[model samples]
Target: MIRFVFAALLSVAAATAQAEVDIQEVTSPGGINAWLVEDHEIPFLALEIRIEGGASLDLAGKRGAANLMTGLLEEGSGEMDARAFQTAREGLAASFGFDNYDDSFSVSARVLTENRDEALALLRAALIDPTFDDDAVERVRAQVLSIIASDEKNPNRIAGAAFDAAAFGDHPYGSSLNGTAESVAALTRDDLITAHRNVLTRDRVYVGAVGDITAQELGVVLDDLLGDLPQSDAPLPEDVPFGLAGGVTVVPFETPQSVAYFGHQGLKRDDEDFFAAYILNTILGGGSFESRLMTEVREKRGLTYGVYTYLVPKDHAEMVIGSVASGNDRIGEAIAVIRDEWARIASDGVTADELSAAKTYLTGAYPLRFDGNAPIADILVGMQMTGLPPDYVINRNDYVNAVTLDEINRVAGELLRPDDLHFVVVGQPAGVENTN
Candidate 1:
């Protein structure tokens, strides 16, 4: 009853916040396409740009080159040195950020209407003519090396790295985005230049803009900003063969609590039954306090402080992963409970009441994501990159609501692999031995 009331209140809040958001697909004179949501009410504009094939496109020998190159983008560009570039940005009172992830390189910028053109020019310079100065390369390389060193002693990182290696084998996805200390130390300025050119190309780019910009003006901005990037000739990574064999692989570490990373193969984002599988996951573990995993492992038995699961639908691979940390003595019990819950959900599915509650929370919480212009712009670019239709923003909640119990159960039975679940435990946990 309490769950139902919370869901009802959230549904009301979502309905109240639902305003008509008009998205226009604009094509620039130079043939660049972008999604735009114009709101003249705000004096600021937020722009988001994504280039697919991010760090995954790094050269075979240089694992961290793409990541290093992304950091250097703002260090210096064209004629402006690092200090001069920053001074110019501060003068305009604008913000720009560049980031490299496993599958994409993203640029986010926010600027007042009066300084939009200047911000765009600065962004263009960074993208087109990055200096990759010798000093900047060494400086950023040291920072990355520091992080890699720190990750070596982090149990969670250790477990994740081991899990990826076991699941992906020789695939590039198995490798860390930051690369090893030796690999990063060996990176050169020329490598950074090549990585920059290979990853940030016109063919792989997607753009989304929101705020006080018209379609005509946005089209002009798109062309002026990205028209000159080299056409992408870089080959994308191949699909990873799913090879996550079941059983625990324990890395002995001295800690009071054992942290475990566990999962099995998962469905792709474009699968017809994705919505059903999504809701099934919610009832099982995606929901926080109300989820079966949390309720069983944390609320009832207190085996762990928290436990959760999520789906990772990458461009080249898909996975359903989860994690939990518990006292060494009780970690085994927690793992058993998680596995039991997985099997039960697969066989029995969720109840009608559970289904209704999942739908309410999922749909109601979605509208909260659109609270800001920058966030909306980010979502728009992500939608384009993922091949979602322009109306996805408006119809997404309907898709969640349309899921029925039958569909959810059928998907659960098809997708869950209790016997094939793999676990990587990182700590000295009693009764948990390495089975690799």
Candidate 2:
């Protein structure tokens, strides 16, 4: 009987996984818009909200203010202090999260259908009425300082910081999200308040929702939660031109293994050849065990335990970046192999067999991401942020499969820059030297 029950549960899960989500574009009376997916199978709802201009909007000399402000959103609001706010959220069995990234501030919430109204009221309080109390600011400031201190000693963090500095110079993109200890220590309640005002504006907001809710109800909820935010007049950071020349930047440290962060200019998201470039990158390095980088660097040569690459399509800049760690003596050899593979892939694209395999795996794996409400909500919001069409969820894999070998090869030749790649090596390496 137990085995039979387990089998039945698996069948149900499979059916749920195969269910299609119907998306609706909702516009509130207050002129707010949201993408919504209604699913009554679950008695809960997931909402994701994004406000453009996150840490990048921090005022001059006040870096990390946005991050600190986001962290303090739920610390207190209206009549509720931090402890009282926690109790209220727990009483409704709901979850609320606020976070700040380089380009956006995000709020995520999950609440039972019956409790959604009360939960949204609480969310509204947090969003529009955050007190940014003195004690709360100081407490969160200390917490952020602790994190900044910890990152100072992290090798990956060091490499990333150096890479950003080299690539972006004095642009906001080059600055750390968590400002220096001195800058953070100097932050005041006024900075947090101004940062909040600059970030949470109606003009920069995108929202998505999933689960047991009607479009009409969602429209009302949207207005109630976000209707009062002021229109943002603050200017976002300007585009950062790629500045790091082809070279090695060595930051001496005392570690047996060296971590290197390397990258060059990348194609924009809206470029017509983006799909082709995406497929080409998969063949070169984006694919984990099956990629050329992983195969040559780890499997055959065994220079490193792991290596990976990704495309960063940010609002202001684009990049094709990657990282690897190996013994100090072997890192130079690994770097040489990486450069060789990069050039080879640029000169000759993937084989027909490889392209077919990439298509099959990518298409098959895409649907697995929408098996839950939160994941669906996330995809919806991301689509809006990247300016994707409402039907993108259904049509994304088609674009991937439609990429031709000729197109991939052309894109690879144009996009890959083996000579222009810059490496920030953070460790004591034997053979590598500063080439800049």
Candidate 3:
């Protein structure tokens, strides 16, 4: 009876939901603010801290500094080495993690209600006082550099690097998050300390928690984790202004297979036409097996095992990327099919059925993203980080439903440019000639 009642309540909540999510904002004694969603359905609590100014803020000379700092946070901290810290958390069956993206670095924890106290203590230590010991720094640096060096030999990496360089010349977002081998080699403990000081701010940080914790308790956790961090009066860096030279950029490699990447720019997250663009992308390349690209390029012709496209919106700009992996012998055929499909979508708009199916798939797939507390917490933090209204998730389906076929067609014609398509191929083609 209780479960049934909760389900009914959730349905009501979903129907009337708006940007004002059912979240409570709590202020800790130490003055840190936290946004929380309380759910007693599970015995665990998930806490996330999104600190503004991630890898994109990597100082001109120090490309990968912020990324390394994120990794060192949990490697050791507050009177404990990495192993000791791992053991302490394992004893309580709690999970602690750290990650960095182009926009922010995040520290997360999931712990049972019974072990909240221990989890809080460890979480605070990792955030407040990291021990970037000399040996630990050297070890991590060596390992990271070794991997970057290995990538230098991989054709796929070569193609991607070349494409980004050509597409967005000097944009910081174009740089690799995993710094170059030389850059990682030059990093020292002081660089990590500087990154933490400059970017980690209580004001710039947002807190999110879900599962077994109440608003008040989660507020306390945020205070403990971030209260003492430096405060920032400035906002995150504005989006990068990126311009593309849309043409073929081929990085000749010795391998027998060719990897093709093509497309141009698109809209950012907060763009008014996001839903329209998203639904249109599903019909073009993003909807997997049901997409026109998949059907034409893979399922029907078998030119490649997998082929797809997507819109990757950055703070300043966005890019439409399409890719295919195929044999060198059929490289010409593969590129021809990709370009033909691209032009078809732009010139000849999708059918009513295609548009309808795309919208249905997108609307139906919305709730699958919130299956668990951790996923929900991640989405909440991401939306918050991107300056989206809190009710964005709850109101998503409505916006998706509001997309008209005309709106999608307009975006398709505006965004997809086969004539301006920048093609990049990374492997040697046995019989395929380079037409362009």
Clashes of each: 0, 0, 1
Tell me which residue pairs clash in candidate 2: none
Candidate order by lDDT, decreasing, is: 2, 1, 3
Q: How far is candidate 3 from the true structure (C-alpha RMSD, Å)?
A: 5.1
Q: In the order shown, what is each candidate's alpha-carbon RMSD?
A: 6.1, 3.5, 5.1
What C-alpha lDDT do the candidate models reach, one value each? 0.88, 0.89, 0.76
Per-residue accuracy of model 1 over 35-126 as CA lDDT, tens digit each = 99997865678899999999899888899999989888889999988998998887777788999998999999887788789888998999
TM-score of 2: 0.96
What TM-score, computed on C-alpha atoms, does each candidate reach? 0.95, 0.96, 0.90
Answer with 1 or 2, whichever has the higher TM-score. 2
Model 1 misplaced stretches (Cα beyond 4 Å): 1-19
Residue 414 of model 2: what lDDT?
95
lDDT for 317 in candidate 3 is: 65
Kindly list the per-residue Cα lDDT of model 3 for residues 278-371, writing each as its tens digit. 8888988894698988899888898888888888887666888878889888877888888898899898878889888877887787777765
